[model samples]
Target: MPTALLDLILPPRCAGCGVPGALVCPRCAAELHGRPACRMPVPTPPGLPECWSAADYTGAARRAIIAYKERGRTALAHPLAG
Candidate 1:
C-alpha cells in the first residue's frame, strides 16, 4: 500500500507540526486552523452546488493546500479535506 511505501521512504512525521509517526498526526491535525461555515468551490471541474469548507484558506488552509499540491504532499489531502 502507499502507506507502507511512505513508511519505508519517509520517516513518520506530522504533516502540520513535522513531529513524527504519520502525516498529520492526531494532535497537530486537530490543531490545524478551522472555521464555522463558508461556501467555497469544489476543487474539481464539474463543480457541484456551493460546497462549504471547514477551514478558510487563509493561514493553515493555504499552507496545507500549497504543500499538498505544489510540494506533492498527497498524504495531507485527507486532513485538508476536513
Candidate 2:
C-alpha cells in the first residue's frame, strides 16, 4: 500500500515519544543516534560477544524499543534500526 494512503488512515507517530508526524521525530532520532559504546551487562554471560549500542536503553530509546518489540509497531523497525 502507498505510505501516504496508509498514513491517512493511521497517522504516523514518533515511536519514541508518541509525537504526531514522523515515525521518529527529529529530536528522538537525534537522541537515538550517538557513538556506539560497549554496554555489556553485569556478570557477562559465558561466550557472549562484545555488545555495542548507539543509545542507552532508556528514555526515548527504551520507549522506541518497546513499541517495536512489545507493542507490535513493526512500522518502527526502519527508523529504530537507523
Candidate 3:
C-alpha cells in the first residue's frame, strides 16, 4: 500500500550506490559478507559473550544498516542477512 505509492512518487535507489530502480543493486550486494564469520575481538563487549558481524560497519554496509534500521526499508534485510 504505502510502499507502492512511495515507489511511484519517488523511485527507490540502491542504499549503497544510489543506483535508481532497486532497493539495493546486485553489484553492492555481492560486496557484503566478504570475510568469514568468527569471534575475533579480544575483549568482547560487556555482556555480548560472543558475536559475529556479517561485514564491517562501514561504507556500503553502514549505509545499508542505516537504510534498514532508520529509514524503515526492510527490503535490505534479506540480502544483508545473507
- Name the candidate that leads on TM-score: 2
lDDT of 2 by residue, 1-82 (tens): 7554666798798887889978889999987887899999889999999999999888899998898888777777888788
**All candidates: TM-score:** 0.55, 0.77, 0.72
lDDT of each: 0.66, 0.84, 0.77
Tens-digit lDDT track of model 1 for 1-82: 5554766787966656677777776665655646667566556457466666666666545666777888777878777766
Candidate 1 least-lDDT 10 residues: 38-47
Better of 1 and 2 by TM-score: 2
RMSD of 3: 2.9
Backbone clashes for every candidate come to: 2, 0, 0
Candidate 3 to truth, TM: 0.72
Task: Count backbone clashes in candidate 3.
Answer: 0
Task: Report lDDT (Cα) of residue 40, candidate 3.
Answer: 51
- Return the candidate ranking by TM-score, descending: 2, 3, 1
What would the per-residue lDDT of candidate 3 be over residues 47-82, giving only the tens digit for each residue? 765567767666887888898888878877787889
lDDT of 2: 0.84
